[model samples]
Target: MTSFPQIDAVYETHLPVRDLDRAVEFYHDTLGLELAYRQEARGMAFFWIGGQQTGMLGLWQAGSAPMRMVLHMAFRLGQEAVLAVPAELKAKGAEPLGFEGEPVREPVVIGWMPALTVYCKDPDGHSIEFLCPLPDAPDPDFGIGPWSRWLQR
Candidate 1:
């Protein structure tokens, strides 16, 4: 039997939105994702995740109900950039939240993943994260900490 081809990284993700315009503003203006293209007739828009020719995120206008299952998506960033995302979001009137939706003052270190991450929500209530691998994280186990405290230690 022939073996299946190896799978690579995710190329794109399709998310349902109630209003294409609003979604576009939130994703492009607020989140800083580049607008790749749009299909107004189909009520759909696409954004370049990291670069113009890199990964893409598609937004389809077809939902009225609130998101039933919370979807989590993370964007990779440098350590300084990850730590700076929360302040930038707040300055743009976006709420930076913790894992449980609590207001966050800093990014949290995910002990298991050994990564620093900060969370927020998009206009459609989808969970968004900015993450970076912790360079000096403990080898065996390092407890999670807020960015402020984590930086001090």
Candidate 2:
């Protein structure tokens, strides 16, 4: 019989925000992620995503109003699932600065990476990406690069 690995901590990350509605708009309406929960007491909101329990995002009503968020975040979307993200963002009034591929809307296929990635800036100026895994691509060294560099792989 085969055994599964013990589960430890799950989820990718939690992003802090000042307004739950704004975050929901950017993540849900703009990015197309489903809004899962909103906690008023905790001052947080969660987006619905798969792969792990609570791998979505968090909205916090702390600090000053939405300043330039220097952090970056990425999410996975399979090949067919990769479509409609940039269009959705543009339709919602967010411009896609650049992407991994061609002129516009051309999904960048990084030979060494496993994602066809498109880049965009959220309302808060934080960078976020929708990545669909390219399982056939050559495995790259994700550990050696800077935090942001990993996204380019």
Instruction: Point to the candidate with the largest TM-score.
Output: 1
What is the overall TM-score of model 2 with all chains considered together?
Answer: 0.67
**Taking the tens digit of each residue's C-alpha lDDT, what string does model 2 give over 1-153?**
889988764475677665667777888877767777888787887776772365767666556654545567777776665556667666788765445322344445444665566778765656787777666646564422222344454
lDDT of 2: 0.63
TM-score of each: 0.86, 0.67
Cα lDDT tens digits for candidate 1, 1-153: 999999766678888877789989999898999999999999999999887656899999876865454467888889989888889999998988876778997888866667888889888788888889887746335566676666566
Candidate-wise lDDT, in order: 0.82, 0.63
Indicate the residue-level lDDT of 71 in model 1: 67
